[model samples]
Structure formats: structure tokens, C-alpha cells
Target: MAGSLVDVALPLPVYSTFTYSVEGPVPPAGTRVLVPFRREERIGWIVGAGSGAGLTRVRPILDILEGEPSVPPELLELSGWIADYYLAPLGMVLRTSLPSALSDSSRDYLTLVGKADDVGTPRERKLLAALGQGGAPRRVRTLRKALAMGSIWPEIRALATQGRICHQTVPPRDPPVRTHRVVRVMNWLSDLNDRENMFRRASRQREAYEALESSGGSAELAHLLHQGGFSRSVIRGLEDKGVVVLEDVEVLRDPFREEIRAEPKKLVPTRDQAAVLAALGEMLQEPNPPPALLHGVTGSGKTLVYIELLKEVVHNRNQGAIVLVPEIALTPQTVSRFRAHFGDDVAVLHSALSEGERFDAWRQLREGKKRIAVGARSAVFAPIPRLGAIVVDEEHDGSYKQSEGPRYQARDVAIVRAARVGALCLLGSATPSLESWQNAQIGKFRLFSLLNRVGGGALPPV
Candidate 1:
């Protein structure tokens, strides 16, 4: 019997979606799948159902990358809108919305099959040595780095043809969630007399147990060991005696974990700021709030207004928010301020972060662990469930416009996303862009002005 047909979008420059057949129940749109494209297999996203009425041949999907949809349904719709508006391929737009790690294709790994000492050339010997006998298969890229040379593909192909090495294609693995082992005292150790008797011989074990007890009976394995200057054997001794149990626990890779968090300050808003917040609060209640332009001069306390408004949105309304800064240079200060106000409720995203860091941050926002995302232009695509507000600071800056394919204006995208999700979009700028100013003038956007700086300070003479 024929399999179900679905439309798949590859990460190529092509403008069209391809049809592929699947064996089991059809994977829903937004699910990632591996499909045969010409001679090579490519990772593609299922956009929708496909019709096999006219086509004589439809390739079967090689594999389904994810059990659940990696791209949310709403994001699929948003990507479609972006593609249409920006005249970009739907696949490219979808790619832009997700972390690059998610789109990595299968890789080729080489392993030694024949005698390594009998190689024809020194380079081949080096390659074989890199893949030691019975060692794990290594990728060409890894071998290249180990050998400190460029383009080993020719040598790899020659070795393979000579039956000196074996090749295999391995699918990309998901990023491992960070985790650490934790130690906890067993309830049976609660008896002081029994605990004393158990630890009478082992002084170091006793000290470690006492430290764990002081730490509420549970602590990270590394921290517990470090605090007591104890070795793993000491903990193992306690574990063997049934005094404590060790287990692994998942931990988030927080980018701001090292920075000392600032104390949150409660500042009274100026009269103008209060009025603007009041107006935005009312707008938030609407089904589809019109985007608002906040024309506040420098030193007008625009950031404080954002913090207050986000407090209401996140704490009161039980929704999420995304704050977009124009440059990576600005992200540190913006994130610091937001983190001070929101604590771990905030997540940071940008190009400066490593691939693993970016993946973790995206996951945090998607899983609702972090309710606010503060970053640069790319952050406008943050997967914040139940989004209630989007704040674009310095909305007029050219940094918000992406220069490559799928050249999107993040400020504009934030407005569209907010509208789609029935959230309030706030664009704040000391000098508003002409398009936004005109939009406000023609009633396309609601206008709010901050006439004076906070603390009775006057604007510098222009």
C-alpha cells in the first residue's frame, strides 16, 4: 500500500516545497524529517499535507528527526507570513527562526579496518593513527583538526577505496541537557545516635555528612565535596553504608549565572511615565492591541517603564515577554537591568553565545522556565509561550534590520508577532524612525510622548 504524502521544505534557496511519503501516521506540520533530495539526504520541515495526484514519483521520508514538533504551530504560521512579506523562501525563514544546531545533517565517520602500519603515504598513516585500532569512529572535520591540515577528503576517499578504512553516516545527536550528581542523606540517618555510631570510624565521612546535614540534608555532589574538602571515596563510603544516596539532577546552562545579580529597586514612576503605563495597561486588555510608539527622549526612564509594564504582564497576567535591543553591545546592559528586575525569569539570546548556550536559552523560553527574553534583533523570534508584550528599545536603529537572506526588520516582526498573539507591542525610541512616526501620525500606531526627563532634568540643547 502507498504511504501518506506530506509537503517538506528543505533549507535550500529553492522556492518550492517537495512531496515525500511516510510509513506511519503522517507527521504534523513543523516536524523535522530527513528526505532524499536528488542524490543526498537533507533535513526538511513538514509544512503541510501533499497531493500525489500528478507526480509519477514521490520519495519516501528516510527518517523523522523529532517525535514532537520542534517548530510550534504558531511559529510556522509566523514564518509563512515572514516569507510572504519579505519575499524569502519559507524554508529559509523557518531556519532563521530556529537555532543552527537543529538543522545539522548527518555526518560521515571513518574507522580503521585494515592494518594502519601498512599505509601508502604519511598523510594516510596519520589519518589511520588518528583513528587508532578499535577506537571510536572519527569525523573528517575532527581528523583534519587533529592532523592540523586542510581538505582530507581526498585522502579519506583513497583510503576507503583501498579497503583500509570504513565509512559510516551518523545522524546528528540532540544536545545533551546539562546535569550534575547530587547527594542526599537518607532518612534513616536522622537518628543522631545511629549517625554517630555509623560514622565513628570514618572522621572524613562524618565531616562530609555533617556538611550535608547543614546544607538541609541535600547538596550537589561537587559542592558537597568541595565544601568539606572531602574526596569522592568519602561520599561513596557514606553511600555504601546507606547513610546517603546519590542521584543526577538536570541544571540549566544560564548565561548570567556568573554575574552578581543586582538588587531590585522599587522606583516611583514620573507623572508622564505613569500615564504612559496606564495607557499601555489598558491596551493590553484588548483582544488585539495596536502597536504603540513611545517617543521618550534620552534620560526619560524608558527602561523603568518597561520593567514596570513587564512586571504586570509576567506577574499579574501570567504571560511572557520579549525585549529586543538593537546591538549586541547593548545586550549586556539591557540583560543586566532586566535580570535585576526579573531574576532568573529572564533568558538571554544573541550571536555572541555559543551554540550550546543558544540552544539551552531557546529551550528555557520554550519550556516556560524563563518568562522574559532579553537580547538583540534575533531575539524577536524567541519562543515565549503565552506572550503578552514585546518591547523594542531603540527601535529606530539600523541594527534591527538583518542584511542577509530573509532580510527582516525585527521591530516590524515584533509588531506582527504581538498582533498575531494578541499581545501589546511597545516600540520605544528617543528619535523615532520615519516609518514609525508616520504610522503614528496616520493612526496605524498609537502614540505616547514623554515630554520631560525624569528627576526634573532638562534635555541638552540640540
Candidate 2:
């Protein structure tokens, strides 16, 4: 029987997806696969199953790169819509939906096989020398940098053919998961007198044990060593006596590390804010509710309405949410507020973060460890499972339109994505965009107006 075939989308400028045969059971859509594209192997996304009957030749997939689909089904459909609506390539759209670290392709690593003196050419000898007598395999890029010349592929290939060197394609490595050692009290002494008698000989161990006990039985190893002035030997001594245990615990990197400590403030909505939320709450109850345009003056408590609505969507309905800010500058403030309310349930995503930080945040949301995501334009694509609401703050700002590749308007994408998932889309702005204004005027969007500012503040002069 013929092997099952699947359609793959390569991250190139091509508009059509290519067909490849799956040697085993066909993987689901959104699975990343390494496949031979012409001469070079490239990473591609599995969009869906394909038919081998129409094609005369279909290359078998080299490997399924991931155990699970990197892109979820709802996101795959959302990416397709964005591609079709923006006239962008589907591959490019899919690539945009994921982190750049994930899209990296495999690279070639070279290892020395034969003695360096046996090489024929200076370049080949230099390459083998760099490989260092069968030591750890060196990346081809590293060898080229050491040679300080362009296009060493010819020399490297020749050396491999001569049996003097061997090359292997290594898949891209993901950013390491952050973790730290923590010490916890495993078994405690029976009583106060018993604890004193057990630790009578070791005062430092007794202090460390007391510290751990005061810290609710566990503390980060670093904190215990530095702040608590405890020595490693003391911890080891406790572990040896079966009084405590050491463990490596995964730690989520917080991009807004300092701002997360802000105290959460509870605010009662103003009469106007309450009314607007009431109307929006009603609309949210409907299936695939129409987008709502919140026309409120600056400082008119529009954000308060959003907070209340999200509380209902997230806490009451038990679904995830995405909050899109217009600028990265806004992310810290926005994330601080959301984190204050949602605590660790919120994850921040934006371009300003390091690759590892972004990956960690994405993983948190994808795994449902985080229920709320707050970021700039790209955060709209945050893998929020069971999305129930999306709030596009300052939706009228031109920053909502991406200026580079894909060039999608994030505000519009948020609306479409929410609609596709049967969720509510809330667009808030003091001065609305022309398209949104027109949509509201034509009743295409349910319009809610906030006339009075909280604390009776006057509206800004137009």
C-alpha cells in the first residue's frame, strides 16, 4: 500500500503548499516536519493531509520534528484566514504566528575522521584541524568563521567525500527551560526537644533547618545560600541526615520582573462604566457576538469596563483572554495591571523580550498555565487555549498595523480571531478609526459610549 501523503507549507515566498509522503501514521495539521526541498532540507509546517494519486513523485518526510503540533488547530485556521485576507503567503503567515527561534532550520556539523596531515589542500587541512582529531563535532558555520572565508561548502564536501571528515545535520535546539535548585525539608524531627538534640552538634545545620521550616518547608537554594547565609555543606548535612531534600524546579522567566510586585487595586466601576459593561456582558452571552466599539474619552474609565468584562469571561466563564496594546512601551504598564489582577495567570509577549523570555511566555499560554496574555501586536497570535475574549486597547492607533512582513492590522486580526473562536472582541478607543467608526455607524459593530469620565474629570479638548 502507498504511504499516506500530507501537504506541507514551507516558509518561502511560494503561494502553494507542497506534497510529501508520510512513512508512518499521518501526523495532524500544524506538525513541524523536516523535508527535502530540492537540494537542501528545510523545515515546513504540515497544513493538512494530501493525495499522492495526483502527483507522480512525492518525497517521504525526513522526520516529524515534534511529538505534538506546534500550531494548534484553531490557530492554523486563523492563520489561513489572515493569509487569505491579507494576500500574504500561507507559509509566511504561519511563520509569523510562531516565535522566530522555532522556525530555525537544521544546520550541518562536521567531524574529523582521518588524520589532518593526510588532507590534500590547505583549506581541507585547516577544516580538519579545526575539527581537532575527532573531538566534539564543530558546526559548519563555526569552521567557516575560523577559516575567515566565504563559501567553504566545496572544501567541506570534498573532505567528506575523501573520508577525511564526516558531516551530520543537527536540528535546531530550543532555548533551555529555566530551572533552579531548591532545598526542602523532607523529614522533620519529632518535637522541639528532639530537633534541638538532633541538631545540637551542628549549629549551622540547625539554623538552616530553622530557616527552611520558617519558609514553609522550602526555599530557593540561591536565596538560602546568599540571603540566609547558609552554606552548601549545611544543606548537604541536613540532606544526609534525611532532614531535607534538594530538587531542581522549573522557573518561568518573568520579562517584567520588577513590575510584577505591584499591589492589585480593586476599583468599583463608575455608573457609566457599569452600564457599558452591562450591555457588553449581554452581548457576550450570544454565540460569536459582533465586535463592540467602546467610544470613550480619555480617562473615562474604558479600561475599567474592560477589566470587569474580562473578569466575567475569565473567572466566571473559565476561558482565556488576550489584551493587545498599541506599543511596547504600553506593555509593561498593561502587563503590570493585568498581572496585578491575574497574578501569575498572566503572561507577557512582545518584541522587546529576549527569545527565551518570549518562548517561556508562549509555552505558559499554550499549556494553559497562563489564562491571560498581554502584549503588543504579535500578542494577538498568543496561543490562548479556549479563548473567550479579546480586548484591543487603543484600537484606533496606527501602531495596530504591522509595517513589515505580513503587514496585517492587529485590531482587525483580533476581531477575526475572536469571531472564529466564538469569543467576544472588544475594541476600545478615545478617538476611533474611520473604518471602526463607519462600522459602528452602520450597526456592523455594537456601539457602546462612555460619556462621563471617572471622578468627574473633563473630557480632553478635541
Q: TM-score for candidate 2, please give it.
A: 0.84
Q: Top model by TM-score, which number?
A: 1
Best by lDDT: 1
Worst 10-residue lDDT window, candidate 2? 328-337
Give lDDT per model, in order: 0.88, 0.86
lDDT of 2: 0.86
lDDT per residue for candidate 2 within 38-152, as digits (tens), equals 6467888999888666677888889888899989999999999988898888888888988887788888888777456744778767667778854888887777787797778
Root-mean-square deviation of candidate 1: 4.2
Query: Which stretches in model 2 have alpha-carbon errors above 4 Å?
Result: 54-56, 111-155, 184-218, 227-246, 257-260, 264-266, 328-331, 459-462
After TM-score superposition, the amount by which residue 320's alpha carbon in candidate 2 deviates from its true location, in angstroms, is 1.7
Error of 2 at 49 (Å): 0.8
Candidate 1 contains a number of clashing pairs equal to: 0
* RMSD of candidates 1 onward, in order: 4.2, 4.0
